[model samples]
Target: MRGRFGVHGGQYVPETLMSELGQLAEAYEHYRGDPGFTTELDSLLAEYAGRPSRLWFAANLTADLGGAKVYLKREDLNHTGSHKINNVLGQCLLAKRLGKTRVIAETGAGQHGVATATAAALLGLECEIFMGLEDTERQALNVYRMELLGATVHPVTSGTQTLKDAVNETMREWTRRVADTHYVLGSVMGPHPFPTMVRDFQSVIGREARAQILEAEGELPAAVLACVGGGSNAIGIFHPFLADEGVALIGCEAAGRGIDTYETAATIATGSLGVFHGMKSYFCQDDHGQIAPVYSISAGLDYPGIGPEHAYLHDTGRATYVPVTDAEAVDAFEYLARTEGVIAAIESAHAIAHARKLVPTLDAADSVIICLSGRGDKDVAAIARYRGHTVKED
Candidate 1:
């Protein structure tokens, strides 16, 4: 448990980064419980970022799917339109406490970048974001939003020109600017302290959901589901329920086209254990250990590797990981929007896709909670184009 989840989590970074990583670990430990720090973070979370997002019972959608009742942990309603705010606020505050004047991060779908930029602006920290050129195009609105918040966006052209490449570019920038900049890693992956630190920040999701659900239903849910890109939201909601033996923890990964095809990002489904992105975790790698190119309709879930804690959970059989195809996710997205007026992020729709499958199999008395991680306004254009329509963004 010391900076690791079983044998999977460890710092696999360059020697140059080791010292900074050690210092970061110490600083995070120190400020994590300081009253002044917690007080400020709590105020921001409540007054600015909007904590305690509603646990909405999706009655119409649940009835339409024809199974157990469903509850949605509406992280999509949070500030910046996702649960990414929860961790960004914490890390940006940590950066301020460390006396850093600048903050940098890697982003894919732009939620993390926007959240980071918003935090930096609020804290008066200079911000820079690294994103793949492809993602910049796909998520153009987010890129513009970051710039509006006064953050520079670097569109990376390396590797597959995607999330993994963005991570590489951000790490390179961090090494050169380590003295004046703090890398606000966006997920529950990366090195030792990051996975643990991010999980702790995100654990608020699970804590809130557990209390809300228990109060509403007067019983524990049968299952809790969340989509897993690097598994931050899943870990956040899963952590509080780990001790409840009857409750199942489920993570849904993106199966871009199909799991059998190379054009998929179903790491737990087809990945092998290897080191990538600063941790020894499961990654989409070839026989000789070369990282594989990954794909998904949801930019946020297209990464080749999963977080080490997810790898540990997979190995120990303490949680279940499943693949949800892009087609299925699109169907769920449309279904939720139509049935419940909730336009879910494509990344979150992956979990909804699987929930549609699982709910039918369970008894009507059972219930499942899905983490609706972000709003879908950013994806409106892409979805409209995919569905053969012309829509204008205002």
Candidate 2:
């Protein structure tokens, strides 16, 4: 598994960053086996992230929807109120061990930026976050949160003023200032060790989902559902279930308004194979293979492409990708708030909305588990704007 599926993950950064990545790879490889590494992470998960986050069986929602069994992997309740901490903490700690004094990150919705900043604060490392100028404006609260955690926020105005552009800016910064800094990519979407390492860090979700489901049901669930922006949460919960023959992995893409809409960001459904951000993978592109701008109510899900590993998984037929529209995701967001006392991030709501559609078609006894990737605190205003109303509550 070297690149693409296994052929596309080589270190593609500038020459200045090559040694840093090499050292990082070596450190991560060593930590991959060290008991102390596992124990440290476990302790953090227990004390910081609240490990073994409840996999609550949604009796009300399931019964209300007409008897289909649904379970929620409650990642929204974690510290920082999202699954982002799982990977960020691991990477930040690894960065500290690598003797990096500065941690730099690029963010779209700002959750990952806030999470990284939080870890940096707790560990006493200098933190700097680069955010898309538009995203910083749209997700101002998260921008404030990052600043509160002592991260200096740099607004990037180049290249669509969005996530991809933020990535470009962050990479340029890393390339120029390779030493004493570590780039904490937010998802399992980057090159080489990032795809494998971030998945390893976030895999705790699936590791718990598997046992929780089997112990509660006495059998594997029929399907696993998660949203795919950069495809981190999907990869987290989908990896452990990949080899399971009976468990179907369904990843939902953000379909802004509709898959056919000019505003959609349904990468797997409408995108073609192309190169983006140092990887040869699926991308939403024009006839000339130039990248297309993407839009979604959830800023985090507005990227025009997905992770390379996801491209591999899709091609191998290990999982299926479905599109969930912004309207449907908002509906799901409200439904969760009304029915389950949960306000899901629009990114996660996409999966929840897709689950809403899938459950109606499945048999009553068929089970589906949805990864509630994050809370919606960051998106309340946007959701309200989309609904043409004031946000009612936090």
- lDDT scores of the candidates, listed in order: 0.94, 0.89
With a 3 Å backbone cut-off (N, CA, C), the pairs that clash in candidate 2 are 2-6, 3-6, 3-7, 3-8, 3-9, 4-7, 4-8
- Per-residue alpha-carbon lDDT of model 1 for 142-256, expressed as tens digits? 9999999999999999999999999999999988889989999999999879999999999989999999999988999999999999999999999999999899999999999
Q: What is the lDDT of residue 54 in candidate 1?
A: 94
Which candidate number has the best TM-score?
Answer: 1
User: Best candidate per lDDT, number?
Assistant: 1
lDDT of 2 by residue, 1-394 (tens): 4544744445566667767777887899998788987889889988988988999999888987774699999999999988999999899889878889999999999989999999999989999999999999899888889999999999999988999889989989998887889999998876677888999999999999999999998888899999998899999999999889889899999999888888989999989988777677788999998899988888899899898888888888889999988889989999998998889888999999988888878888788999999999888898888878876434
Lowest lDDT 10-mer window, candidate 2? 1-10
Off by over 4 Å in 1: none
Collision count of model 2: 7
